[model samples]
Target: MSTQSQPSQSVLTEEESWELLAGQKIGRLATSVAGEPEIFPVSFEVSGERIFLRTKPGTKLAEVTISPRVAFEADEIGDDAAWSVVVKGRAQVLEREEDLAEARGTGLVSYLEDGKTVWIRITPSDVSGRRLVPGDQR
Candidate 1:
């Protein structure tokens, strides 16, 4: 008889989660409006512990303003393993000159050609991540 090890899933530490987040340039922003949920794909930058992204005046911006609480997710997949990180926090629009200037320092640009004039910052209250290794299943 032969014995084989199974695949495993594990929760990532906060530091590991942040590291994964910092490495990714794109994430999904989750927001709720009028008891409904919406997700927007955004190009983002991670500085320290916060996430920043640029947006135009539209659904994403409007929904975030209407409900400041939001969740952001980023993930990566490899041939042998996969991981995902979720950040839950409040989203704030940067209106102050200093904040706008700091956000600009991040050099975050929109993937779309549309003008993205607004800067939004997400300050996370909870950040968690999970990693799955497929072992031989790969």
Candidate 2:
């Protein structure tokens, strides 16, 4: 028997998207400031379908404060397959001490040493993902 294969992409379900988010440690957060778009690499943690990240007072925080709407993306590539997920939502700054304390318990840390004390929570309202697989696996 002979089989023909073709490269294909599949859209991940909402549950699958959340699963990917749960396992991902780092993602690019895209925000806009002064009509210019910017993307920042952020280490994050997932809790109850929401993402938490730590940031210091800087351009990222400033932009987020100006406009809470943002897009976040993460991806994983394998030998012959890959998948990517994107989240679109609003970023809310955790100002309350209790909220910050709770976010701190999620094990989310920053690689920068500037002391990123600000915690931002991204609540995804539209989460989507796609997976690419070699046709041979089909």
Query: Which candidate achieves the best TM-score against the true structure?
Result: 1
lDDT of each: 0.93, 0.90
TM-score, candidate number 2: 0.90
- lDDT by residue (45-103, candidate 2, tens digit) is 88888889999889999999999999999999998889999999999999999888879
Q: Which regions of candidate 2 fall more than 4 Å away from where they truly are?
A: 1-4
Tens digits of per-residue lDDT for model 1, 18-128: 999988998999999999999999999998799999999999999999999999999999988999999999999999999998899988867785888889999999999
RMSD of each: 1.7, 2.5
Taking all chains together, each candidate's TM-score versus the true structure is 0.93, 0.90
Q: Which candidate is the best by lDDT?
A: 1
